[model samples]
Target: MSIEVANDANAYLGMKTLDTPNSNNYVEYDGNGHLTIDVGEHDDFDGPDTQPGEGVNSDSFTWFDGMFQLCNQGKAEANISYELPDPPAERDIPGNWTAPGDGYDEQVVGFYYISEGGDDPGEEGDRIFVPEGDSVPLPVGECREMGVRTVTKGVDATTDAPLIDGDVVVTADSPAAGAPNGTDPS
Candidate 1:
């Protein structure tokens, strides 16, 4: 089990340069009821000191239930300090990445699809929130390319894993956020 953090201060940190590469990191749900992500940090437009706060770093238990279709990461009454993991060596941005949510004009740090109604509408396992504006329904897996900085970590099931360029298929029994007529799911 691992603890993750996504602080608000780090969501939107700076301007995306004209030549900047579109984020390749994303999350996906495998058609067989599993959501997997290639872990990494946000695009660091600002330096570490100016980046979002660190996450609590401590020993914790992390678990994912296939039956209930949930994923959890948290410390038992411990605060885990978090630091942005160093980006890959070849990228244009080379420091800890902050949240685009905090630095940019848009309220959404990234993009995601929320579940409208189902067995677990808001529950982590049953509901689905795609981080980068890819809209689809649950149980219907799709590859979405998106990114978001760590908002806050240490709390139970708060921050998701650092995702790299990869594929995920939503297999859990979750109803997509926008359904029928494009109404907000929350």
Candidate 2:
């Protein structure tokens, strides 16, 4: 999986991992505040590079990409959006090609805001299994910590928790300080 973070300031941060077989892993966001986390796969290939009927011929291709925004602008909220692969039954399968199941299943993505200097997670400020494409508004206060996690359906919810967890200090915007006007004090 790959992870990228960006904001209005033009600052960018990113992380990625090589695709491993049958391994479940994820990236976390541990930054200051007001950043978006883009998660998905890149350049996934399923068929051989040879001519069709001469080599392996896959019937269909599929992939997923999405972005979740953690904003503290007017109100602390997490805006989530993602483009998931359509159902296999709905896709067009090419003739004279083998269409292997994409193995794409419904999963749950979660986001939360933790209290400053706190270790235990309470019932408050926790958005569990957030809708696939929706925004979750946070409580009325500064969020000092933020976390993200993904889990496959029908699995233990606590397993494979957030691999990325860190502090985040949301700061309100303010006007730039003006240069010292004519008066010289000392």
Candidate 3:
């Protein structure tokens, strides 16, 4: 499986870009039915530091970007697990500011499935709340196209700073035909 982080203009950090792996992006499911990817820190920024008592600078913002793909190598289906981090709050924002932080009330990390024709899967896609965790199922011999993103609630989709994102692919061998696929295959 291969994953590509979108290169949108708004998602770019001043001097710190996503430190994605140069190779080995594919995630294999272990016998325990779980796969984990550790996406390290936010990019390094070359911006002015705010001194004590100084207010928040408009340029000092958090940014987020992510995407993933699932490749089923086995004859059985499987589920992919991922957890989204909570949206930034007044306390989460890093700066010497006295004003309240612009909290993202309904922020979410969306996982969209793309059809063979490269069209959006629409309602069939998954949208998980930030700071929450969930999983999605993938069929055997199926290669699914998916796009992951972070956005604030109610407002248009925009990237934020101080964000970290990653993914994991899980599979179960010998899954009963037509049975549910995931970490808990009950």
Candidate 4:
């Protein structure tokens, strides 16, 4: 995420031009008319501020069914399918001695999918699991969100491992099922 794209990135953090090999974590996009939404990542690490697991973060209780949705992250309702990985959320650590974040997923990660309960619309309140191969259209300015099951160390983490990665494609709209002459009616 670039400082320009970060949801509340420090606006006054002046820099002497981020150029060349000195710039860390930089990517360039060609912008060929894609539904690429800048992840508004409105959340930040509340260190040790962890939410209790839904009883599936342990071997003694290894069952969980949850719902997730796609947020607008744009100015209009859009239908797009994208396979993205867990956000790279890095946190502060004490001292130079360190540990890597891997193999500890069950304790620190959450998995999300279109569970069979998706047919029930939602598991809790407005949190609906994504429909199979589909999305629940988001209103403009919605914050995109997702979850993935992983194991981890309690409270804190250092590095982030890749979860899911793929391309994003926006399909065209189709005519209403009973449209006459295959033409959509406003």
Error of 1 at 101 (Å): 14
Candidate-wise lDDT, in order:
0.28, 0.31, 0.36, 0.31
Q: Which digits, one per residue and each the tens of the lDDT, describe model 1 over residues 7-119?
A: 32111111121111222222333444333342234454233456532332222322211111222111111111112334334332213332233233222112332233454
- lDDT for each residue of candidate 2 in 34-66, tens digit (9 for 90 to 100): 343433332333336743231111222212222
In model 2, what is the error at residue 2, expressed in angstroms? Answer: 33
Q: Choose 1 or 4, whichever is better by TM-score.
A: 4
Query: Which has the greatest lDDT?
Result: 3
The TM-score of candidate 2 is 0.26
**TM-scores for every candidate against the unseen true structure:** 0.19, 0.26, 0.36, 0.27
lDDT of 4: 0.31
Off by over 4 Å in 3: 1-67, 85-105, 108-110, 115-132, 152-161, 165-186
lDDT by residue (tens digit), candidate 3, 16-120: 112233112222234443433322322332234632221112323322222334455444655554444433452242222122235543324344444443232
Point out where model 2 deviates above 4 Å: 1-69, 74-122, 125-127, 138-145, 153-186
Please give the RMSD to the true structure for each candidate, in Å: 18.5, 15.9, 12.7, 14.5
Which of 1 and 2 is ahead in lDDT?
A: 2
Question: What does candidate 1 score on TM?
Answer: 0.19
